[model samples]
Target: MSAEPTAETLSRPPTTSGEAVAVHGVTRRFGDVVALDDVSLDVGPGEIVGLLGPNGAGKSTLLSLVSGQRRPDTGTVRLFGGDPRDARSRTRLGVTPQETGLPPTLRVGEVADFVGGHFPDPVPTPELLEQFGLTDLARKQTGALSGGQKRRLAIALSLVGRPRVVLLDEPTTGLDVSARQALWDAIRQYHAGGGTVLLTSHYLEEVQALARRVVVIDRGAVRADDSLDAVLRRVALRRVVLTAPADLSTWAGVVRSRPVDGAPPERQELFTPDADVLVRDLVVSDVEFRDLEIRGASLEEAFAEMVAPESTPESTPESSPSIEGAVR
Candidate 1:
């Protein structure tokens, strides 16, 4: 960094500010379309939360409200016990949007140090660069970096201020496997240092690896909010892949079954509530099977079940609390 890091620039935000985030009955709309419907969530101080959802599931909209980029049509959003819209509240906040516009001409180190200058106390540019695995690219211009490097720098920029609460929107979107893991490690270190984080992602592995507390959202509403294990248990569907000669669609506990397209028509997939029960049924019926494999359903399947229109008869904002209450 061209700017020298001084003692005055190494300060940190107060860490005991109770709840770092509080959203109550937030509603936002664009024209006639409701982007968010009376959604409310809380993230305590020093907690890491991942808002998991598919594209356009209101994940970005909710993060926008929390970061004060946009206001909710109705309801409130608080950060560190103050209105997020207020400058004072935002001073303690650091945010990375779904996409960031970096000055192409500026070097990576220069951009970081410049942003750090805006805060009362900021992390040292070199230290921040080391944390995000960007130290090697410090002299490189922002526009010359690869997509993954740019993403890593975007997230690193959010932490330059050493803010108490950090909000990240789709932090690893479009990143490669290695770059994503490197960014995840940086985020983990930030959380390890007691920095409260609220991030949104459509990647299941991203949420699964980073967040202990997850809030699943779909179609502009909260579907499930709980521990990762509890969320997985709630959608406990097993996927059984095998080569079965007899039809498995009629098996007990089978949610859905379909034949996989391949040579000899032997491959098939059986989605069931209990793979053991289905296997027992198969054994009792003398059905021939081969290459059998039983595994837990993917997050995509769980998300599908959560958002499936036929699964829930009630899809109104008024019923949200009751459903959430039931989950708790």
Candidate 2:
């Protein structure tokens, strides 16, 4: 029951400067605490950008500003080059916040229709429900759906208006693997039809799968914003796993080493900047090792390094000049 792109999907408004979303030097505070500090970001039309950060790192607050739920204290947020706070500007924008309050007594289909009725042009309720895998729950009351179903319906409603840009805050927080993949497909379909998306997720793999560009925020500041490959490459660490007779934790070229849990005592995993150099050292030293394996760092490893307490701004790769000072 997948829905094909409608005429409205192909007729998005031309963006100013080719930017779907623009946030410049935005700052927001909550009494004594600064939620966002001089953050600036831009999402081009038709791009899927991932916003990543720890809890209370201002990720939600930033989305609130972009979605016009909250105003910035000292900067500007624009949707298609217009003030986001303006209703006319928001007509083309869609948002799924971390929490949504659906009508308890309304059926799923009824809620979809109610939301779609607000826009001049909207995706048909049936098609939208099918695309999100909610057709079976169409007749069920909103409060009766499971947590994951509610999340899917919330995301589907965001697209009822066929918006040019959508902001998703933890869209797959409660979804299972299958449900998450289904939602990913729906997002891809929307993007293929020239829609722009900005999403935040704790799942690193979600960002790795959907976004070409990644923006990492921590401590109320932009830590790094660059292509996913560039961000991963910035962390030069590689993981090497092998079974060795002798302890390799103190070996030269090994940045960190630990025993592989549930494995034999000889099985060790090592982190090193250069796997080749470490292997060379192992061979030269006549180390007795077997089952050797070497692989590049994962997004999780890269993220850990990026937000590590010891990481300083000066240590950041020159390619990611957008990174602000170290997380304090």
Please provide, for model 1 over 1-328, each residue's C-alpha lDDT reduced to its tens digit, 9 standing for 90 to 100: 1121232123433445557899999999999878898899988766788898777789889988888889899988989788888777888788873334888899999999898998999999999899888999999999898888889889988989988789888899888888888788888777766677888887777887788788999878999999977875666678898987766666678765555544355677777777888888788878899898999877555565576555444433322434433322
lDDT of 2 by residue, 252-294 (tens): 8776555665689789878787899999998988999999999
TM-score of 2: 0.76
Please give each candidate's TM-score: 0.79, 0.76
Cα-lDDT of candidate 2: 0.80
Which pairs of residues have clashing backbones in candidate 1?
none
Clash number by candidate, in order: 0, 0
Give the lDDT of residue 144 in candidate 2: 95
For model 2, give the 10-residue run with minimal summed lDDT: 319-328
Runs in model 1 lying further than 4 Å from the true structure: 1-17, 97-100, 235-238, 241-250, 256-269, 273-277, 288-298, 308-328
In candidate 2, position 3 carries an lDDT of: 26
State residue 130's C-alpha deviation in candidate 2, in Å: 2.4
